[model samples]
Target: MKTVAFVPIKLNSQRLPHKNILPFGDKPLCWHVINELINVKQIDEVYVYCSDEKIINYIPKEAKFLKRNPNLDGDLVKGFDIYKSFIDTVGADIYVLAHTTSPFLKSSTISSALLKMIESNYDSAFSAKKVQTFAWFDNKPINYDLNDIPRTQDIEPIYVETSGFFMFKQDVFTKHQRRIGFNPYIQEIDEYEAVDIDTKEDYEFALKLIKTLNENGREQHV
Candidate 1:
């Protein structure tokens, strides 16, 4: 399949100003996911979709740069708007939507998600974290009984979707105008791989985590 992956990012950030370009470790925060995507063997091409030309310097030479409309960079613009614009610009059999905030997402994990969507009956697959602890929604207890309480592990696991990545067939996205499909598969990821650096606290914590990973030889090289 003609698989193409893209990382959608902008200079304007509401929290942690310039978080995308800020140094996460040796490289910029956004560089990690881009490097991982570039290493994916199944991916035919990797593109950094950003409005700022300066971002070209931050990304690796292997990945192509696609300048997008600045209007889509606004915080108010929905993510679907960016996907629609990019999908219209770049034609592909498969589209992998990745984010700069998810620096710890691994290439192997990404490859697994894409492979599942490609080889199976699943139309789309996205990274998620499975939580077995007690959860609540709208003042109502979830995964628990009012009369009886169960251990955290005994409770049914709830899958929480991460901003890590989303892979979908072109037809599924174009036809439904959504990243997810009717037959979606969840790619469960560990807490370490599920890290998303959005706020200042998140960024700080991620910095420490990356350092620890690298020290422990857990970091994968491209």
Candidate 2:
């Protein structure tokens, strides 16, 4: 039914200061995600939640802007609380949580995830990357044991939440107080699409990857 995409952004960042407004490929970093969400046909509306008023200049006219709570503006504030605030204010049947860090995320992927959630009767859906490589924990092999080493292809794939985007029914948040519910679906995306800009190194890597992809004539779906 009715779905809305929310892009939560803040002015302060610990690792990469002022990263949300940093210069990305063509425009500011967050603009890429904002524009993508606005273009998605499945989404009825797109909202930009930010504390800074200056961000208004970057967001397109098609999207709406909402001021974030100043109390939740600190770096130590939990993201779950911020999301709860959004839910409490802007009511929607389905909410699509997206991040500016994932600049390469595509509108088609967002639409696909939402469609899958509806068709499959999933309470929630999130973007993830399929991981099949060997993993270790507590100084021991996790997926494979030293005694038995199997081919990588034979190993079962694990899905890692990319935090790129999430689609969930409002009831999911009301019941679990979180974006993900008990019956959640994971939409697998490629590693490149899952890239999250947290640090300077990550930003550089993403820029380089974007440049390389463009050079190869690969059109970025977003």
Candidate 3:
């Protein structure tokens, strides 16, 4: 089956302004995930959907580039719209949605998720991180209560969508109008790989983590 990976990027970020082009490791932040996608053997093609021409220079020649619609450039624009636009314009049997913020995501993880989704006949698969800690909602206890608090280890794990990556068939998106389908598989990833840079502190933390990983000769895992 033909698979295409899409990395949606915009120059303007509300929390961290111009974060996509920020210096990260050896190159721009977005390049980290972009390059990772290019290395995925399961992906037949990689594309960057962005409004900024400045990013064109950084994108590798092997990946295709498509300019996003101006109307959809605003921060308030819904992500579903952008995704649907891409599906309509650039057709593919399977689509992989990868985020630039998830710089630590490994190519192996991407390949593994795709393999599982295809082999298991799952409609969709998304990268997530498992959390076993107590949770709360609206002042009420969730996953735990004061009356009978379960040990952290014994607590049922809750998977939090890390937005690291999403693999889905074109029909899944057509039916749900979302990246996730009715029957979706949660592909758990390590905490390090789930790091998403959305703020200044997150960016700094990622940089430090990258430095530490490199110093320990573990950069290849990224």
Candidate 4:
């Protein structure tokens, strides 16, 4: 199947202005994910979908530029709309919806997710962090009972979806108009890989982490 990856970027960020273009190590923030996608052998092509043409200067030569309607750049615009727009514009059996915010996400994990999703019976797959601590929801304990409390390690784990990537077959989206299908595959990643830069503090931490990695001569895959 023809698999394609795309990172939907908007120049104006509400939390952190022009965050996609901000300096992250040796390259812009968005450049990291684009570069990782390009290196993934499972992905046939990588594209940077943005309303602004300025992104063309930041992306690598291998990554294509996909011009999207500016109207879709609204703060209230749903991700489903953007997914549909991209699917309609580009033809592919499988579509990879990646996020520039997840700069540290590895290409090997992406390739593994794609291969696992295609090989397994699940219809879609995405990355998430497994929280195995005492959890609560609606003011009630989720994995523990008030009368009988279990050890944190023995508690049921809850999965929190991260801004890493969403892999789904074209038909999965066409059928449900959603990124996740009936039965979804969840890939667990470490805290370092789950770092998503959505706020100013996150950006600062990511920048520091990038510098630390460079100082130690560690690759992005780590």
Q: What TM-score number comes out for model 3? A: 0.94
Candidate 2 local lDDT, 89-195, one digit each (tens): 98888999999999988888888888888788798999999999898879987787779888999976677899799888998897878788878888889877899
> What are the Cα lDDT values of the candidates?
0.90, 0.87, 0.88, 0.89
lDDT string for model 3 (85-137, tens) is: 88899888899999999988999888888988778878899999999898887
Per-model TM values vs. the true structure: 0.95, 0.95, 0.94, 0.95
Query: For residue 88, what is the lDDT in candidate 3?
Result: 90
Give a tens-digit lDDT track for model 4, residues 4-56: 99999999889999999998877888888898899999899998999999999
Name the runs in model 2 displaced over 4 angstroms: none
Winning model by lDDT: 1
Off by over 4 Å in 3: none
How many residue pairs clash (N, CA or C atoms closer than 3 angstroms) in each of the candidate models, in the order given? Answer: 0, 0, 0, 0
Model 1 poorest ten-residue lDDT run: 213-222
By summed lDDT, which 10 consecutive residues of candidate 3 come out lowest?
Answer: 213-222
| Candidate 4: worst-modelled 10 consecutive residues by lDDT | 213-222
RMSD per prediction, one decimal?
A: 1.5, 1.3, 1.5, 1.5
